[model samples]
Target chain A: MKPLLDLSVYLVLGPQDCPGQDPVDIATAAATSGASVIQLRDKRGTTREQVQLAQRLMTALEPLNVPLIVNDRIDVALAVNADGVHVGQEDMDASKVRELIGPDKLLGLSVSTQSELDAADLEACDYLGIGACFPTISKDDAAQVGMQNFRHLTEQATLPVVGIGGISLANAAQVISAGADGVAVISAICGAPDVSAATKELSSIVAARKDLG
Target chain B: MKPLLDLSVYLVLGPQDCPGQDPVDIATAAATSGASVIQLRDKRGTTREQVQLAQRLMTALEPLNVPLIVNDRIDVALAVNADGVHVGQEDMDASKVRELIGPDKLLGLSVSTQSELDAADLEACDYLGIGACFPTISKDDAAQVGMQNFRHLTEQATLPVVGIGGISLANAAQVISAGADGVAVISAICGAPDVSAATKELSSIVAARKDLG
Candidate 1:
């Protein structure tokens, strides 16, 4: 069995997400406030740069007891011993990742369409991130799954589901109420003026919803 | 102790090296014609593309008994279970790479300068690739080590040496004379109209030099 992951208010970030601010600082602040986990989704840059950043993030998040999840690059995740690795529809095959990362590490897979959800290997994944819960611009190619579809998928998912893409304090409560175990955000906290404040608000909403659940 | 390597003629290739030809075909033909080893040094494309290419190359070279070495990307090398991984002085640290690859996999490091040679962890490396034998245009940043420096460095190396970068039939003999255990080439074989013929000539030169020694 894989170790438990507290994925509530999961923060997804990258160099592209943080242009003026430091990602480590943002991640640290987000975790301190209420982010349960963080994913380093770097699409561009050399492997050396990615490794250094992941190492720093892992060290910073260690004391906070927050998991540092890496996106796409399994090597970086393995090199730094990140808590888990997250892959999308286009990334490496989830089964290969599970084999390389071994049984102990957490593995998360993205699901949007009914086909993708149906095809996902639940045994290999610790959690499933389902959404594009709203239409905002973190990713250009994200498959849009609004609140109704998001709720429908979350209900059918055997594994824990984290609603991602465009989630914020405004709709985080709705996401949780709709049956999602957590809400994963990219720009919500990282792009906010007060990263900690944004995280705190989202966490409260999740807490309130969980109390009712 | 490390396993004895057959370092007669090593072929280094990437998509950039093969313009009109397929890299797998070139590597396969080169290995059959007498290239002792092959390294997939891909610099462009997505990790998906790199992994697929590496897997194909490994399968193609396995029957020929030519070891496939992946440069810079430890994940691709690990994903495909290639014979080993090769990194340059500017790539991942040799010690870390050795730890990730574990003891059995072949690890090769690029040592073009005396300082690099001095700093190299010989205990962790199966071989050292030293070069830029005549300064042709395979890589613009390659350290240009003419015959004299090549001989000097090759003689000083405790690990087996494969002279790489800009090496071809004309100067492969000279590299062998310079005490290199093998010759690694990019454009020489991959770019040749007849890759097998070019590899055969280089292999013969290396074999003749070894017989004389």
Candidate 2:
């Protein structure tokens, strides 16, 4: 049931020049290059080595079950119980990480403004990892909310935003025609030579704009 | 030589009701009851038990030297390299926590609004904790910013705000005359029966309101 949320073309893999790509080989090469949602931001390990690399990237995405999110360690996403956590606007406050990753998990919140996406609460989140959008070499980015702040925060959000930090595939359909419901990248699938054809050309350009109307 | 920044009072002691309280006995009982700065919120350990309770609350406040903030575990405040890390408006972007707590650490971000303190970056922080100020039993609240948003984020801040949830001592000098430079508490110094006379009655009503201004 929670498997159909295809977090829409999102991918962020960096641990320095893909240093022999790990997190279960970058979540099995960004879930067979259609990168739906696989963030394992490795800020130099040790929560028992990021919960043994989020338990070998949740047992190598247990055959593309695709949902291994764990960026800012909510206790190594509750000690390797990964599948939720992306917090950043300065961390821990989407109603306290939805009361410590509970209400059916998967809480993400890395917005860039529009007053922290209207001081975020978005019903204790399920999505909204907004962005750095343009100014990024991957990191050391301070402020750069471009793509016209993704059509003014997906035309005033109601949850489900994605679009994080310097998305690629040549501006990924101009950030999904400026109202992203998805598009997050880190050096386009960890500086791809071919992370499954750059995540199947940004998931077939977000599945051919999945009814953007 | 860092002790004068003590904006009155702020405390929170609950790690199984204090006994040899960690984070240097909840920051030397909030700097011997006249607390200037001491944020050590340990949400049930293990980053090696909150880096050995922030290295035994930074060695029991290294001879009462105050300033020891480490709430959202930035690698246990850079591994007991405590003296800065409050983060929350949602945790890591007061300029990437002032670039991983650099430029001589001490970041603190949490502003509720006034457009996240006017899209804060107010020189990448040194203060601005603001808060719940009134309605809080505390399990990580995120939408209460009242008391007229403490006179509109204290006339649209310039940093140095610190008002935190449910402050006591009967609303502690009306949250330091609603321009708060300090007034943080958790059931007034860990539900005081005398946490140093409730930290000297909220530090003598925020130092007798500078003789009522």
Candidate 3:
């Protein structure tokens, strides 16, 4: 059986965004403060370093029962024994990732437009990371998916949706209100002065909005 | 211009091999002791972790001017601005990795037999990781490519060849004598009590044999 995914306040950590902080510390803080899922999203680093960090993060997260998701790098995911992986349009296709990761692990795909959603094999993915709900510095190339489109895409997707791209406490509720099951942020948490506080604030907003439904 | 790849004494690091050793420390020790290329091979961990690790390894390797190669993760390679990527036959096709990594970065492909070599897009690859010269615990599924087949594959390849799978200082000379430009090893180095000494020993053997040519 596939494992359950907690999409609420999903935090995607980027080393570039964290600067002085260790990824493990940031992840632990986020998880402790109620970030439902933590996706490690490094675009730089050797696979060995990645695995080392993942092992460290896993040690911190396991006690909290927060699932650790890897972004791309199925080999790393398999090596670290992560809960799942998230892939972008340029990364391996969702179906192939599903085949490699198998039925048990969670697989999330990024989709910014209706066409991408149409092309994606929803059955292969446990959830959809849909957006740049707004323009995002987190990903310079991310095509903007305005509130209307974000809502439309969320409604259209058969899988659960986590709104990504430029998401913050100020705008996160809007995404949840627009029908996103959760909001995924990078800098909002990683770049925060206090990662735990940032995560807590976002989690409360998501919870409040989710409760309204 | 793209950075030159030493290929000689190529080291592939696996998380399983280094229980307590930091990959960066191992890589640094290996590079300092004359391992020409370092390939980070992790079958687990998130992409973020991999990139972070790669960045650290890159920092350790940069001053020594050693190239850092990622195993089976073009996205991580691209994100970390790694020197190149190595892909197995079961992973992304070499042509696609070539296109994504572009003209400058090195791209290596793994081939176990002549058929696999013939099927590969040679123009897209800078080198071939030809294996398993002997049965290997590093990868349980690796098909054995005894010395004769290893020689045959090396002779058939147009690109530089690195004989992998069960390579060690004891047998590494045999692979170099079989026309391999280098040897790629996992446990042989990472599992060593002294990674630098292991790398130095392997480098000396590979060098002496290559000198015979």
Candidate 4:
């Protein structure tokens, strides 16, 4: 059985944030530095490219024992034997993804509102990507969940929570302190001048806040 | 109002197949050369990148009057205001996508068997992408529908049928003859040494066969 994931400093990489960079390399840098998990979030590229990238990332991450999660495309995740997949409200639901990926793989759901959270089959997901904690360019339509709502939502969530959207070292601790088990970032680590350093800082911050609890 | 998609000579572009080519350029070439509809099937890349590519394809295809259909990512389709989204069984269901994209946009569902076809809420789909009429390297998991199954399925399908998976200039006419209104191709167009020429040839073959009907 695959080990349960540590959601701390989860790195979400997309081509938009890491233009001209190999996704595997960017993920390797972050995973090696401190990111606990890596989620490949490509909304464009063929199944072949996605599978190839996932395979490369799996090769790189498996030795580190870091889990590679594919976002939105379960077929790509399965094709490359990735550790898991993450889906948003607009993507396939968690139950269906669970059935497809099976029980061994981690399944993540993106939740923004209390009603959505209430309706979610919590048993189907390993973690919840609770997002838009602040306005984010990562997702233009992501509704901001703000600190208060984020805290409330996390407090009630049975599944682990990884705060996403606009997360960075500067505010990651705040999100963790607000009750998220970790912070999921896109541009913060992906577009940073030094990805490893950025990941380390975010990891330390999330760790410190979690330690405080 | 977006013009009703011709659904003839539909081109499906994937980053893996295109290699170094820009999706917009390939889509433009295909559209101008006689492709009737363009489906951007990027199984990888961030939502931002997908939306940007869809926007570029929309810009390239709009004047030519070819509809741009996004594969799987409803958020990206909505973000760029593209013509529609195409989803497979493992992806989001057509009904949910229809609810999200609304009645104004096109919605396509991929069906490989009679049971899948029966389970499908046909009213929710604007068209059906039916196939694997032969073995297809494009989707490793696609079950070959063969000409007989393709003909039977298309005969019963109330929605327009676009045969996909392994469809090529050599076999496209056969699929059209089998009852598909069109053929959705990936490698046959995107990987060709000359995309426009390839698209033109396939379009002519499909048109000629379609004309016979």
Cα interface RMSD of each candidate: 1.6, 10.4, 9.3, 9.3
What does the lDDT read for residue B125 in candidate 4? 90
Greater TM-score among 2 and 3 belongs to 3
Q: Tell me how many clashing residue pairs each candidate has.
A: 0, 7, 24, 6
Model 2 CAPRI quality: incorrect
Model 3, span A1-213: residue lDDT tens: 555788998999867768877888888888989899999887776555676777788889888999999987776677667899999987776776777777999999999988999999999989999999987898777999899988898998888999999998889999999999999999889888888888899999999999998
Cα lDDT tens digits for candidate 4, A113-146:
9999998989999999897898899878799989
Fnat of the models, one by one?
A: 0.27, 0.00, 0.08, 0.00
lDDT of 3 at B49: 66
> Tens-digit lDDT track for model 2 on A17-123?
37676546765877876777788776665344565667777778757878878876775666566777777765556675666557776878777879878888888
Task: Name the better of 2 and 4 by TM-score.
Answer: 4
Between 1 and 3, whose TM-score is larger? Answer: 1
Off by over 4 Å in 1: A1-3, B1-4, B134-136, B145-147, B211-213
Please provide TM-scores computed only on chain A for all of the candidate models, following their numbering: 0.97, 0.34, 0.97, 0.97
- Clashing residue pairs in candidate 1 are none
Listed models, DockQ each: 0.46, 0.02, 0.07, 0.05
Candidate 4 lDDT over residue span B73-178, tens digit each = 7656765778988888876657666766778999899999999999998999989999888888987879998899899999999989999999877888899899
Clashing pairs in 4: A42-B44, A42-B45, A43-B45, A44-B44, A45-B42, A45-B43
In candidate 3, which residue ranges exceed 4 Å CA deviation? B1-213
